[model samples]
Target: MKHDEFIRRVSERAHVSAEQADTLGRAVLQTLAERITGGEADDLAAQLPPELQEPLRRPRKAPADPFGLDEFLRRVGERAGVDGELALRGTRAVLHTLRDTLPHKEFEDMVSQLPTEYRELLRVDHDEFVQKVARRAHVSVDQAQTLTRAVLQALAERISGGAAQDLAAQLPPELREPLQRPRDAHAEPIGLEEMLSRVGEGAGVDEDLARRAFRAVLLTVRDAVPRKEFEHVLGQLPKEVAKLL
Candidate 1:
């Protein structure tokens, strides 16, 4: 898709304003340039609109830093002056659209340079999904299982109504019950600290442990869901909560 059409589709799917979508697209593309190698970044940029290619063309003072999807989103959120949630949504929109616009071989080449988890985000299956989380978090399978449930339950609570349903449909039948559980409509939106505290409480762990578990869960889900749908879920959250995702 062209830049304008790409932004329009992202705006429509993410339920953000046109200006917000533009801001998001630019932020994600710029941040992505910092994550991949200079050569791969250039190759990817060549496929983008002229206006969108500037970030990739800018001289890098140092090598691209090693980071995962969470840190990548954090950087994008900072650059975009939006919450982490919006950044996540914007990133998904741009990346997934690029996958559609680029040739199969070209897209595969770009993906090859990214970390394994990055590829997992693009096409996550159930078994691999759990294994990736366990490996990334450095936890046992049982612990990963518990963390995944907590994160998904918290996610279902925070995202929009339609997004919640869509996410439920993506999950296994055994895992669908948590998303279907009734939520308190009058509950207020909480910040990252409060949200993590709740996750810690629910999982009976300390704050530090809760944060680690949340990260594992968030990263896994971010990759498992379709990009646009993930974006919608992020857009519905408070900026603080979104940053964690």
Candidate 2:
């Protein structure tokens, strides 16, 4: 793809301006180049637009710098003059766009060199989260969006404040907002039926739809969060409700 299109895609995905996208994309590519081998970086540079190629090409003579995702994001944030959160979002956007545009084997080869924690950058974003809910619940994206908010709001209310904050940390910004709202220090211990009723009321849907949406949201959350964190969340719930997750 052309440079403009590449930047545009990153901007849209990251919800940033074109100038910001350019800065962030270059930051990520530069950091990525440092992480991968010189030869692999050259291969990656060859596939990208000429404008973006330089960042990847610069470090081709140096040995790969071994680092985890947190360190990678830190470097990207430092380079881009942005905070860690924006750096994470921008990196995901650039990488996701790269995955969409690059040859499958090329993308796979590059990712293969990285550690498992690096792969977590490709985890569900807001769009993917909504799409999963829509697909699983057999609803439209609009309806799924509503259902997602409803269920998550109810979930935030039911779980302890710490658990809710931890869960929010794993999700994309849009989905994270609802869970970040103020709540009690301890879990509310609301029953499954009550949670469903709250979801139904919040979403303006009936009982069946509410149940389906609740299940869909929880299932997505299960995949989105770490097993230990999710277990912590489940521990706050009754057996009947925890089983749904």
| Top-scoring candidate (lDDT) | 2
Off by over 4 Å in 1: 58-63, 123-245
Give the TM-score comparing model 2 with the true structure, all chains together.
0.54
lDDT of 1 by residue, 1-245 (tens): 68788788668645799899888888887787788777777887888777778877645444666888899889888988988778777777677667656765567676666787775446544555666678767888777777777767776666655567777776656556666644433224666677677777777778887788878876666656655566676777678655665
Q: What are the candidates' C-alpha RMSDs?
A: 16.7, 8.5
TM-score of each: 0.48, 0.54
Pairs that clash in candidate 1: 121-223
How many residue pairs clash (N, CA or C atoms closer than 3 angstroms) in each of the candidate models, in the order given?
1, 0
Reference-based TM-score, model 1:
0.48
The residue-by-residue lDDT of candidate 2 on 108-136, one tens digit each, is 78887899887687777888888879988
lDDT of 1: 0.71
